[model samples]
Target: MNQFTHINASGEANMVDVSAKAETVREARAEAFVHMAAETLELIVSGQHHKGDVFATARIAGIQAAKKTWDLIPLCHPCYFEVEVQLEAIPAENKVRIESCCKLAGKTGVEMEALTAASVAALTIYDMCKAVQKDMVISQVRLLEKTGGKSGHFKVEA
Candidate 1:
């Protein structure tokens, strides 16, 4: 069996050395789902969230989260990145879909960054709408696709 890359035989966490790993342009995308009351969804669609400009605020939070992924996840390397965050509200179903794409030039891919951005954006949605929809739930934060780097490309097909 393969040992956990981040853990040593001594059961201590260790940062993986990537000194010999080739540098490459890498990109990754992640997605998340936020479920809320249909009435709240309608309000969001009508630009009625208690906080103004939900989409704009969530987008900025996602970008900031992507840039700070390393600080949040101890093992992750701090990477310089380019990122885009897209939010689509489904008023009919009282849900929102958040997608975040992250790119970087480094030895390791930015999959964690993308995933973190998606998760943070989803939480931001829940936070911004909690007063109106206390039951809001954030779910299904996951990596959708990734490309470049040593591992090559991966896609989580629907």
Candidate 2:
């Protein structure tokens, strides 16, 4: 059976010790989707929403969330990283697609940071547009790619 990295021999949860690990350039990319009604999508794409610049708000939220991931998640090490978040209003799909990337030179990977960024960005969109549409659904949050660290490189298969 595979052992859990956050568990100890005593079956207690604990943060992994990465002090001995070598620091390297690590990067991770993650994605999320927020599905909504056609009218809601139209409001976002047409830039007529009263809330003002949904994409810009979401982008800032994602970047802030990435930097604070260590504080939000238990057992995660504090890391300094650069983050980029992009959100697109896809009217054809009636949804907003969010992609986030986090990069850092550190002992641990930045996958969690990237994932958190994407998730928060999606949530921010929902919060901003709830007055216009309350039934929005956030889904398909996943890590799309990762590079560096001991794991080397990984990318989702098309």
Candidate 3:
């Protein structure tokens, strides 16, 4: 098995040194789900939420979060990348599905950025809708796929 990258021989936590790793096109995609009441979903979909433009606000928040992932996470390296965040409100499921994709040509992976984007996006949704629904649940924050670096390509089977 491969040893942990962030741990030195002395077992102290440290950032992985990707300096020697070749610069490759790295991309990562992540997803998050926010479950809420059907009424709350209707409020957002119908544009009747008092907060105003919930989707737009959440989208902006996600993008901002993706850009600052390196600063937020202690070990993440700051690298330029393109980020896309999409939010879908599923009425039948009474949930909002947020998906984020981050891509860049760098020595390190953008998985943390993608995951951060999705998670913060979900949180923004909850923050906007909390007035109406206090019990909203943010769940299933996960990495859906990643490509590039030594790991090559990965996609969740289920």
* Cα deviation of 10, candidate 2, in Å: 0.5
Summed backbone clashes in each candidate are: 0, 0, 0
- C-alpha lDDT score of every prediction, in listed order: 0.89, 0.95, 0.95
Report the C-alpha lDDT of model 2 over 28-140, residue by residue, as the tens digit: 99999999999988888888889998999999999999999999999899999899999988888899999999999999999999999999999999999999999999999
Lowest summed lDDT across 10 adjacent residues in model 2 is found at 1-10
- Candidate 1 regions exceeding 4 Å error are none
Best-first order by TM-score: 3, 2, 1
TM-score of 2: 0.97
Which number leads on TM-score?
Answer: 3
lDDT of 2 at 76: 92
RMSD of each: 1.3, 0.9, 0.7
**Alpha-carbon lDDT of model 1:** 0.89
What TM-score would each prediction reach against the true structure? 0.94, 0.97, 0.98
User: Clash pairs of candidate 2?
Assistant: none
Question: Per-residue lDDT tens digits of candidate 3, residues 1-158?
Answer: 97988889999989888889999999999999999999999999999999999999999999999999989999899898999999999999999999999999989999999999999999999999998999999999999999999989999998
